[model samples]
Target: MAEGGKGSRSGSDSDDQSAVETNLTATVNKVDGLEVQLVLQVRGLKPKGGLRSFLSKFSNHDNPTDLCANAEFTKWDVTSSSLSIEICVHTEKERKKKKGKHDVNTVNTETFTYKISNFPSEIRPEKTTLEIKQPPGETSYSFIVLTLQRVDKSVSWENFRTPRNS
Candidate 1:
């Protein structure tokens, strides 16, 4: 029957959709004095002109296209203290700049302030880690650990302050 054939086709389409995989990578950089930026890059999206592409436009699903990174810092000096910083980046398509009559594509970078206290107070760089959770699907409940090591070895308290007058 025609209905049965249509149902089979839909099932096949769903299978093809599930076969699409999304890959993400996170990187951290210290741009300025005590200013740290975390960048999340997403790949493996369905190309233009396809069923998946059309469905993505209509669906309200929160795909991994957009990602948010949160950094939590914990320190214990007699008492335990914590600080949290969150930053989010929208997909390339979602972030478009209007240049005259046409839209211009530009590299999008999301940034958040990272306090020096987040790192151990020492002369050497240290390793810090954060976990990223993906959206619900075949890879649902999955977590990715991002390990970032400070690249600057000369950061110290003296560099952060000016000399006091006697």
Candidate 2:
């Protein structure tokens, strides 16, 4: 009886350890025009809700925004122990049609796959800032800085400009 009790307690302790939440960190960069890539090394991950449970709820709902509020890193690849996501940055002119209003420069984003097997050699380095925000009413947020140096300087206007006719 004593041995069985000890075994059960050890199993319960292991289960408790596995349920602990872990914070994830990642490196992000923009490569090849408007593509943003993220490289994450994660040991374990847990969303606010279970991934499958959230997806099931999302599929039954008509509004797409609900899914965005529920899930994290929806587009990810888990191979062995690494995760990568390649997203696209979309910029649009948001014009408010009111009694009198000017055009607004608002940016929106979409996700796409960006593979970086052989990075270009003539690209310069640049830095990008990222801010992670929770839902509008929540007070949880994070700021991250990323270094992305991949610009081709050879294609600038100085290389192909002719002297203006004076």
* Among all candidates shown, the one with the greatest TM-score: 2
Candidate topping lDDT = 2
What's model 2's overall lDDT? 0.29
Candidate models: Cα lDDT each: 0.29, 0.29
Question: Model 1 scores what on Cα lDDT?
Answer: 0.29
Cα lDDT tens digits, model 1, 23-139, are 233333333454333333222111223465456546542332322222111211211112223332222222244566444333222222222234433321233333344444532
Worst 10 residues of 1 by lDDT: 1-10
Residue pairs whose backbone atoms clash in candidate 1: none
Give the per-residue lDDT of model 2 (tens digit) for 10-108: 112111221122233444433445333433322211123357545654354332223233223433332322223333223233456557765444433
At residue 128, candidate 2 shows an lDDT of 30
Candidate 1 lDDT at 123 equals: 23
Q: What are the runs in model 1 whose C-alpha is more than 4 Å off?
A: 1-23, 44-166
Separately for all candidates shown, the number of backbone clashes (residues 3 or more apart, or on different chains) is: 0, 4
Which residue pairs in candidate 2 have backbone atoms (N, alpha carbon, C) closer than 3 angstroms, thus clashing?
124-151, 125-149, 126-148, 126-149
